[model samples]
Every structure is written in structure tokens, then in C-alpha cells.
Target: MGLFRSIVGGISNLFNRNNDGLTITKLVDLLNQGYSLLQINSNIYDIPEIRTAINFVAEKIGSVPFYHVRADNEGNMDMINDSFQYVLTVRTNKYQGPQVFWTHVATMYLLNNNAFIMPDWDNRGNLTALYLLPFTQFQFAQEEETGKLIIQFQGNSSYTFYYDDIIHLQRFPTFKGGASKQATGNYITMVNAMENQAVKDSETSGRIAGLLQTKVNLKSSDMKKKLNEFKDTFLTAENVAGLGMIGSEYELLPFNFKDTPLNTEFLNSIIKQLYNYFGVSYEIINNIASELQYEQFVDNTLKPIIYQIEEELTYKLFSKGEISFYNKIQAETVDLEISTLAAKTAFYKEMSYGTIMTRNEIRRRLGMPKGPPELDKFLGNKNFQSLEPGIYEVGGQENNPEDGK
Candidate 1:
């Protein structure tokens, strides 16, 4: 435990890309120990569609309210406002608020299909702050003796962590769960290649405008030197562009990339597939989702991720004994229809007849503060007593239509 805490204590060191690497000029030396080199290449995050989808999901789920509710064996549940609650509701860590913290976890989870969050502790092992591990990936294995889960963060050096100390979220896992190391790799490879090709084509025009051909004796080495000089003097110069009078000695052979009809429709089809893989749509992200669309989004997309989060937090934050007592974490789902006053009252009217939720609960759902204790009790519906067929008669006597009265 001491070693784990010490490792997490160096969280700042994990993000320091510079000053940690040895100064090496040679290509082979950069690969040596004590030197860290990051290869520059296009990855999934470079794609705009993926970024939009990820940000949309993270924002929607991360910004919602999470409550720490304790239920007794008799079925009475009460919300508990504790240090953990404060961490979840207000501030999560030294630098990040709850939304930022959750967004970080969600983004990482979407990128890699797994994200780990570590709870910072003080000298007495009390929870001080909560945040995601900055590393891109981690390896997990079981202890030989205790069978407890162990985590080694992949980096220049592995940092060991007990699974008990971290909140591990994995998506699309098989039996062993190791295959998620590059979950996005399978989908993004084709998309990456296509986007890279598109980028190269886009950058083609910027590289060179055209070639200058000579009408004179083509093998004049002196003319070749003069041509290079002219290109360096005129074409490559930044300020001189758009209109230049070329000498009749040269014909402009403008180079243009073939206007190949890239299967843009095909690209979009694949993009849609990617979006569906992450469970996002253009409507929800753009704030144009209809009420039904929003509800469906919540049910199909956000609920699964949020459910996983709740289960993880509940199990990790509470011991087995506490879990038996019904200590749990829950997310307060947001409804799009409740934003308007008319819809709020109409929904409240419907719920009033159902007699399930108390007034305070309804108020809380409607974005209002809690009502007085008197309104916290559930209301009884007199209309619910007519389930019996005989009880539905207008008068005390039964109707005699069958008897032809």
C-alpha cells in the first residue's frame, strides 16, 4: 500500500514529457534506456468524427448528478453527504472538477475501451482526491498468493498498483479481458488509411504549383542551373504569388492531383459505422435531438456506460458488509422534456395520479429544490380503488343492461 501511494504521488511526473528524457542526438541513441521518444503519427483522435462522438458522450454522462444512497434492510433509503459524495459532486481532484474528471475517464475509456481511475489518499489512508491515471494503457495480473489484482502502467517504467486502489472500467471484454489493449485498432485502421490519403491529396497543391519547361536546347546544364535559380528566386518565395509573367522560353506545366471521386459516400458510411460503434449520433451532439431521440440515446448509449460506472463505484467504494447494507452509488438521469415549464407540470400531473414518487422527488427531477418534509410522503390515489369490475358502477347498485331493466 505504501509503495502504491508513493507511485500515485508522482502523478505529476507521469505527464512530464520533457526534462525526463535524456538529450540524445543520434537516431539509435534515442531508442536507448533513459531516453523516451514519442513517434509522430496520425491516431484515432486525429479524426474529427471520433472526437465529436467521444466528446458528446463524455459531456452527457460526466455532467449528470451522482448520489450516494444508503438503504436499510427494511427498504428505507437515504442520501448520504460524505467526503466521497463531495468528491463526486463538486471537486474530484486537485486540478479537475467532477465533470472534468469524469470526462477524462470517459474519453480515455472510449479511446482504449478501458480506463483506470485512482483515488488519492492522505497519510491516514483517507480519500483526498479522485482522478484518472494519465497513462494510455495498463497491464493487469493476479497476485500469485493472494489472488488480488495487480496493475502495471505501461511506460518508460512500470508503476505497480493494487486493483483495490483503482477504479478499472473495461468495455467489450472477453474472458481474460486482455484483448482490449487496442480495441479501437480494428475499426480505425481503414479509416486512418483513408483519412491519411485524403490529407496527402489536400496537401499536394501546397507542395508545388507547376514545373517550368524550356523550348531551348533541353540539355543546357547552364539553363538547368538558371531554372533552379528562377524557381528558388520566384516560385518558392512567400510574398510573390497569384500572377507572374513567365518568359515565353518556358511553358507552364501545372501539376494537379487527379480529381478522383474518392468514395466520400463510402467514407461517410464507415464514419456512421464508427459512430454507431460508440453509440452517438449527429442529432444528440448538435443539441437537436427530439425528445424521443434523446430518450433513446440515454437508454441505448449513455445507460450502459453509466451502469458500468455505478457498479464499479458501488463495489469499489463499499466493502462487502456495507454492500449487504445496501450502500450504493446512483446517477440521477437527466430528461430533456423536463426543461420546459409546461412539460414539467404535465409530467407532474401524470405522476400525481400514479402516486409512486413523493413531491420532493418530483421537485428534484424538475430541477427544483427539495420541498418541506410534509411533501416528502407519497400521496395515495383514490382513483386506484376501482380495479374491481363491480366497483366501477356509477351508483351503489349494479347496472342491469343484461337483464333489460
Candidate 2:
């Protein structure tokens, strides 16, 4: 029955035509052909460096909490702190949670240069659930006359979704104006090479460990019998471990194949290149990055991606009025610890004395609880206070111009 169904499905797929009259079979064939064009290739997930790079960025982005805020008529932004925030950051849908969904989306975008989010709307068009689609499974197409975009999920059991109902995130810009696109650049080649090198190294190591060869001198007539006897006696694991041959005629020789040492430096170089390509520093990968460098990594590499996602979410999820009021999503910064208490103290002291940041802002940076409303105001040391137009005092009380008179 299953075989019959599969056959029927295959037949249906062969004849299945999309809105543009392209058969599913032809599309599948084209996709297969495209994949075959690459000499050495692998899934992004299979490559450790690629996986690490993508996950490093994705996990950091996912770990940071997402918040929504709207600007009032007077233009002061306030946090929404509502159900929508929960839906967006905690639980995306019934089947999948937010972190997993976002991680998958980030992985897709990094690998394929595209990601998709589909919102499941309720009766009144309110979003009930958000789902991340497999970007590779879907292709975007446009109507000739109406110019409406369509998403076709290619498989034996296919599904079609409207473009308006889906949120698309594209990494590389498509200035030529095509609906369907491939991933950007030749990073896949690097990933493939790295994977291939690792495989070769593993195979070489296995050969060195387990491979054995023996040379024996025996009469031609007795060769077969002697070989069988040798296999039964010395080749057994127990005999190989403990047995000692008392004959000088038989010799056990280790296989001596001089192999070039694995080019570890070359592998390291490739790893570094992959890390740089993905905007991950070697220090971060090796767990040796300073707090400042880690912060900079987040800012320089991950923040742009966060901002992109925020902008897209804001535009797609919110209404026009909400958007006009500057309602948007934001990813919180991941905090890093100072090297020492002295460093932390000096940092906070400078921040406070220079009035560089408000007390609450300082607390937030230090991963502390927010202080009272008064702490929200930026206040410098009394010694550094400006008094009476241009007069300033380092330590003494302020001298009024009238008092001198």
C-alpha cells in the first residue's frame, strides 16, 4: 500500500504544474543539477567550522532578549511589555519555541542567504503563531500580470503560501530583481575543503592505528595451508596479544608507510579564514577573548544582524500606526565581566564622576538591579560641579561673586 502511494505520488509530482506551468519534477531535476555542479560540497551543518560560526552568532542573538517599544505622540519610547513580546521572544508557536525557531532561522540565513518566517493568523488577522520555514524547501515566484509573490514548497506533498503572509529575510541584496536566488559567494568551497581535509586526516589516522602487514617465506605447495594456519593461530585477537612464535623462519613485520604529516598549520589557517569570513574572531573561538573584544564582536558582527531582524519584524508584525509611532523589536546586549574588581571599580567611577552614564544605565551595564528614579538622572561629583556661570571648585565650597563683594 505504501509503495503504491509512493508510485502515485511520483506520477502526480511528474505531472504537477505550478502557477507558472513549471513541473515539480523539472524543478527537482534542476535543483539536483545545481547541487551536482559543485565539485566538493557539504551541508552547512555538517561542517564544524560553519556550524560553530553560525551557531556562535545565532545562539548569541537568540540568547539576547527581544523587546518591543512604541513612541508616544510626544515621541518618548516606552516598552510594550505585553503578550506580543512573549510571543516573539518566548513562544513562537505551539509546536516550536522562540529560541529554537530563531536559531533555525539564523542558521538558514547564514547558510542559504535567506530565511523565512510565516505567521499563523487568527480569525481577525491577529498572529497566533509564528513558524520558521526551511528556506531550501521553498522557492519564491511572482505573478506575471498581478505582480504578487508566491512561495512554493517543493516536495512530494507540496504546499503553496502567499508572499504577504510570509516574512522573508534576505542576506544578500538582489538588485537585479529576481524572486528566486541562490546563496552568496564561494564560502561553501572553503567549508567543503576543510571537511574533506578532516576526512582524509581521520582516514590516515585509522590506517596508521589498525592497518597491519606481514611478510612470510614458505614453499609454494605449502603456502595455502600455512596461510590458513597463520590466520587461525596468530591472527586471532587472543593469539596476537599473547602468543610467541619459537621459529626463526616466520617473521612479523610492521607496515612501514611514510606518510606526510597532517598539515595542521594549513588546517588552522583554513579555520581562521572561515572564522574571519563569518566575523568570528580566533580569540572568541579559542575562549581567550578579553571582555572588550567579546563586546566588540557582538557589536560589530551580531548587532547588525539583530538590527536587520528588528527592522523586518517591526515593519511586518506591527500595524502602520504602530510603526509610525516607532514600535520596534530590540535585542539586549550580552554582558561580559571585567578582568578584576579594580578594573570594574575604576570603570564605574569614571562613568559616574564624568556623568558619562546615568546611575541606572551604569547598573544595567554592570548587570545590577535598576535604581530609583533619581538614579536615572546623570550626576557628576560635587567637586566637578559647575557653579555660578564659570566658577568651578575642586573640593572647597562654591564661592559666590556676591560673597566676595
Candidate 3:
């Protein structure tokens, strides 16, 4: 039944083949004659009027998109007509009795209709006229070097248009909007402010130096006399800028002291350790300490040895292909977990005044991250959990699923 319907449909199409100006038979003939709607060569080149018409429409639209115009032969023009296609024509001086003639193919797109129709040119007596509907078919031909716009449109009838043609036809308004432009005066004002701050900072440094000499013991002859000249020179010339400590009535240090240099060597050692482990600078270490002073003070002992120990541990772990093991504490040994206790109790503790506080001090010396308040979260992490009672279980095997199978 399907085959019978198909046969009838073919017969019907065959009879009505020529309804749209050209028949299937004529199209086959054109192909056999080596001429198609999309011909490799067209005589259109010789027709200046037609060439002028195409250029006029193209220029009015906008810059010809790079993909639209194509070149093949030395002198040839290829015309592609899609549903959104426009083909402008200019009448030649000599006119044959017209079945139809067209001047300008007005730009219009018929999306739903899916056709490229050439509209009829409005004609008065002397002027010729023709109708153009959106063409249902299109042609892509290699441009020819010469000839009139009239092509031997006899054989090649089946045509196709590219989707790019429809996209190209879209109109876009020129955009001129942008962010507000900064005035020259605004930039000059910023430059001036920056320069003024730099000058003020220089003046402040000078004043600070004067204050240190006058109010601080820095320049006292008696103070100088107490120190060996070599030690004095070393201490004086180092980059040990002092910080002023202002104390309240209840504070441990009740008076405000300015420019009292702290131990430079100690600070430098701390900075060196931080830099070696983390690749930070002295300035960065100082900034971190100032920002989080309590945390910095807690890890005071670590300041001297963190970088070295961390480096050594990392190397050892790599070479051994394992971490140094730690023993897990049993429930009964919970009392031995000194790091968790607030104070020490006299027992079998290693340190004098044996207590959890002392163990914490030791841990701080080892440069560990802070202990957790909740034991579960803390013990869950291997770094913290390893501190439990047992020694490491080295060379332990973890079963592979594949091996078990």
C-alpha cells in the first residue's frame, strides 16, 4: 500500500513539474548541457548594468561579509540566493518583449514561507517591470570572467541556499555606549595625593629617629659604656626597628616605652625559619605575627626550628615511603593524653610539673597546628590522631580488592 501511494505521488509531481517556471525534464537537460542555476561560468561579467546593480545593493546593505563574495576564475561573479536573498537588476538599453523583467530585488526575508521571491519592479511605460518571489531554490556557481547577466539557465534547475545567507541579512544598530571616560584632572589629583603621602612618610621617619635619640636610651653615653663596642656596633646597625609598647595601669608593663628594640637576632632567626619552610619574606613573617600575635606567641619555640625540622621530615618521609608511625591510645590510657589537660598532675609524666599544659608547650615547640576543642574532629585527621598513645605501625598492609578476588 505504501509503494502504491509513492507511485501515484511521483506521477502527480511529474505532471506539475513545470508549474514554477521550470520542469524537472528541463533541469535535467540543463545539467546534461553543462549549465545549471549555479553555473561554473556565466556571461554576466560583460553586462555592466547588472554588475552595477548587484554592487549598489550590496554597498547599501553594509560591508560585504568576507564569506559572501567568492572568487574562482580570473573574471567571474557568483550569485547565491537563499530565502533571505536579494538579487538587484538594472534594465539593459535593448529590451525584448518581456514575459517579465525586474529592476531592484527589494531586500526582504520570508522565514515561514521558506522561499526567495524576486519582486516585480514597479514599471511605467518606458521602464520595464517584473515580479520576483522568494526563490524556493538557489544556485551556487563558480564566477565566470565575462558575459551578460543573462545566464544559460536552461539545464540546471535544482538550487540551494546557505543558512549563512539568512544570518547575514540581520540588521544591527551601531553601538557607541561605553563606561564613563575619566577626566585628566581626576588622574592628576590622584598623582598629587600619592606624592604628598610619600613626602609625609619620609618626614615621619626622620621625626621617629629624632624621638628615639632624645627619649630612648639609644644615645646615652652610660648605656653605650655598658656594652662592648663590637656588640654595640652589631646591635646598632642591624634592621631592628623598635615598636612602642603602651601599657595601661593594669598592664604588666605600666609605662609607655618607645623605640625599645626587641632581640633582632631572635626575630631574624624566626624570620629565617619561616622563610626556609614556607618561602615567605621577613616582611611577610612580621606582618603575620602582628596580625595574629597570640598564635605567633604560642608557636614561639617553633620559630627557631620549624623550617629545618619540616624539611628533614619531608625528606625522610619520601625516602622511607612511609610516615613515622604513632601509637593509638586505648580508652584506659585516656588519662595519659596530657595535651588535652589544662594543668599538669604529678605522675609518670616526662616533664617536671607533669601536666597537659607542658605537653602543649612541647607540641607548640614542634610547630603543629592548634589542638581541636572537640576530640572527634581532631582525632579524625591523621596529623592530630597520630599523637595518640601508640607507636607507629609501619609496613602495614592494606588489602587490594583485586588481590582478594
lDDT of 2 by residue, 42-142 (tens): 35556677778878877766666677777777867676756567787668777557777677677667666667676544434444566665435566677
For model 1, what is the C-alpha lDDT against the true structure? 0.68
Candidate 1 backbone collisions, by pair = none
| lDDT of candidate model 2 versus the reference | 0.62
Model 3: ten consecutive residues of lowest lDDT: 325-334
Give lDDT tens digits, candidate 1, residues 1-405.
233434455342222123242111221243343332112112666778888888888887777777889888788988888766888888887667888878878887787777777665554434567656555556668767677776666765556655675677877775644245544565687677777778877777476556778787756787789688777766655456654456677787987545553577778778877777788876666678787787688788888888888998887766677777788998877453354466667778788768867888888865799888988877778877556555342433355544522
- List residue ranges in candidate 2 displaced over 4 A: 1-42, 72-75, 137-153, 157-162, 176-261, 290-296, 334-351, 354-357, 360-377, 382-386, 389-405
Stretches of candidate 1 exceeding 4 Å from the true structure: 1-42, 123-125, 181-259, 286-293, 334-347, 369-380, 385-405
Each candidate structure's TM-score, on Cα atoms with residue i matched to residue i, is: 0.67, 0.64, 0.14
Cα lDDT of model 3 by residue, 1-405, tens digit: 123323343232122123444333444454467543212212332223223333332232221111112224464434333111222123211221111111111122111112122112111211122122223233323323332121112223433222211111111111211111212233334434444455566565534222111223455675455334434554555647543332231122233333433444654454344333222334433344343442343234222222222232233111121222221110111222222234223332434232323444444434676555442221232433336576544443466434432
For model 1 the local lDDT of residue 324 reads 76
Q: How far does residue 314 in candidate 2 sit from its true spot (Å)?
A: 1.0
Candidate No. with top TM-score? 1
Model 2 CA lDDT for position 274: 77
Model 3, global lDDT: 0.28
CA displacement after TM-score superposition, residue 138 of candidate 2 (Å): 4.7
Worst 10 residues of 2 by lDDT: 8-17
TM-score of 1: 0.67
